[model samples]
Structure formats: structure tokens, C-alpha cells
Target: MIAASDLPEVIPLFPLPGALLLPRARLPLHVFEPRYLAMFDDVLKTPQRLIGMIQPQDGEDEGLAAIGCAGRVTGFSETGDGRYMITLSGISRFRLGERVEGFAPYIRAKVAWEDFARDLGAPEQDAEFRREPFLRLLERYFEARDLSTDWASLREAEDERLINSLSMLLPFDVSDKQALLEAPGLPERREILAALMEFALHAGDEGSEILQ
Candidate 1:
């Protein structure tokens, strides 16, 4: 459990559009590119073992989105071919401050974590989230996409887990996923997820455009 004060001021930034890592969620990444392989190696030697997952803007070279989630490297393996398979466990969301240039081969950023201190603790199980509506919309979206999921496990997941998992796994556009990442809390994120799923079900093959 990382405390707010323990958060690092600088972290390596991995800019992957449409990939999100909410607090307490886990995201697996395959690191093969030389720059990122270097980043992975550097993180392994650091005590914090942290990385920031952010989304790069689609056009105009406007740099990264203001917010991103910081993940701790909880699982790691180095392949004989010099690749890395790693799992990052989300610690908290952070607001980007300024880009620092000295990291070499990869980007690093100054981050602010005060706004997301709440993420350092587990979400309350009894939080006021509308589960029935969310589940209904999720089912509809899944059916439309011809996607199969483990219903039993999804049904038993805690609210925070369910919402965060769906937000990360859903095929929404990069902007929509960022909305979920930047949402104020679990209930609001749940609401946005349901709304996005409902919209997707109605938009047919063009649903991603609606999310944009």
C-alpha cells in the first residue's frame, strides 16, 4: 500500500492511446521496442518500480493527456531474446506537470498526485453505484460485439473491480477511455461506462465514432 507522501515526483511515461490503468487494476504490457526495453530495465533497478501509463493525442503533436495512472511493476520476466513481459499494478492517477529530458530513450514527467490520494485506499464496497444498469448495458454491448465473457466471475466482482475492468477492456475510443480514467470516482465512472456502452449498442458499427 503506497501512501500519498510516498509517491514519486518523476516517473517514466508510456504513451499508449486507448490503454488505461485505473487505480488497483493491473495492465500487462509486452516491452520489445528498444526505448521501452531500456525504460523497463531502468525501472527494475529503482526501488519504487513505477511507471506512468498515459495516452498520446491523436494528431497535431500536442503531447500527452493531462492525467495518467501510475503503476507499480508487480510482475516481471526477461525473455532470452531480450524482451520483457511485465504486469503493472495501478497505484493512482496523476496529473502531468512538466516533461523532464534526462531519462534517455524514453520520456519522463513530473507528476502531481494530490488529487488522486483517495486512490491510495480501496474503494468502499457500499459506494452508491448503479450495478444493475451498468450490467445491463455491458451485456448488450457484449452481445452486439459477439464477445464472450465469464459471467459468473463478472457477476461476483466487486463494484470497483467491475467498473475499472470494463473501462480498461472496452473498445471505446481513446478519448472515451480517458474520460473514464479522469472521472472523479467510482460511481461517476460507472455512470459514464454505462452511458458509453448504451451509446455503443445503438450506434452499430459506427459506435466508436459516437464515443469520440
Candidate 2:
């Protein structure tokens, strides 16, 4: 039930390479690196201890992508070793505004949730858009992963949870994960997921399954 206006208008986000935060999911990050430890320290000083988690572009560890999800500091406990053990509960995805320059160690960017659409129920388009393809893609994904799934539970799950969980659980490459984070809407995201799952399965068709 939370909306864009209820959250902080501007948030300093940590741009992490090879990681993505999808709405309604928890992204746990270990902050031992000096840069990210500094990032956590900066969060403690702010009234709104929220940080957007965005994946860095290929070959670029410092620069951020145009889109990322806003994450609230749901879990924080310092370890005796001085590293931070923290968890981020996804709120809403935001658009990256600009990079903030400072000596805080980690690169940060301003983000706004205004343009981001909160993924809730199924889109207004059609049940068919979500139903048939989603089930098919999920079935293929589980089979390919050799995972034993509870079909009954999956059948009862809503579209948002199904899509978000799959995006996180699947062994997709970093660039593909970033694409999932940037997907326009639920329907569009689901469609792209269908394509990604199919490609992953077929990528092994040359008689060489890479994941093996």
C-alpha cells in the first residue's frame, strides 16, 4: 500500500556490480569493502536510511545504470570484525538522477521514484498475458535447473511474487539481470523473462550445457 509520495523524495543509492534489487524481495549485502562500509556509515547519519541498489554496467564498476530499486534498511547489525551485516528490503524502483561526488569511498547517485511504477497486481492488459507464458517459462526454468518445485504453491502465488522471485533465483548473467531491473512494467518484464528463460535453455543446444 505504500506509494511514491510516502517515501523519501531523494535517496543516495549504492551502485553494486553483479547485483540487482527487485521490488518485494530482500537483497542482502555484506559491507566489508572500505567503499561500501563508508556507504553504510553515510546511511546511518541520514533520517531516511534508504539506499537504491543498482547494478553497474559492463566493464564499469563505478558508473550506475539509469534504473534501480529503492531499498529500505530492514536489517542492520554490526559484527565484531567491524564489517556491517545488513539487509535491504525492496520498496520501489527509481530512476537514477546523477552521480554525487564526494570522498565517501563508494559511488552514489540521486534517485527518484516518481517515474517508477510500483509492481502490484497483474497488469490491466489480460490474464492470458501473464498466465500461459509464465507457467510455461517457469516450468522450463525449474526443469533446466534440476530443481524440485512445489507446483501447487506456485499455482497459488500471484504474478508479482512469481516474476520477482524467478528474476532473483535464476542464474542470469549480470547484464541480463540489469535488463530485468530496467524492464518497463510487470507485463513487459514477464515477457522478457519468458524470452530469457527460453534462450538459457537453448543456449546449451550445441551439445554443451555450460552450467554443467
User: Candidates' TM-scores?
Assistant: 0.92, 0.81
lDDT of 1 at 126: 37
Task: State the lDDT of candidate 2 residue by residue for 72-151, as single tens digits.
Answer: 78888899999988988777888787777776666666666666654432232335565765687778777877877778
lDDT of 2: 0.74
Residue-level lDDT for 94 in candidate 2: 81
In angstroms, the error of model 1 at 138 is: 1.6
Model 1, span 1-212: residue lDDT tens? 88887888999999988889999999999999999999998998998899999999864236889999999999989899999899999999999999898838888889999898888997746367766766777788889989989988999999888888999998889999999999998878888888898787767857567777
RMSD each, Å:
3.4, 3.5
Model 1 lDDT at residue 46? 90
Spell out the clash pairs found in candidate 1: none
Which residue pairs clash in candidate 2?
A: none
RMSD of 2: 3.5
Among all windows of 10 consecutive residues in model 1, the one with the lowest summed lDDT is: 122-131
Clashes of each: 0, 0
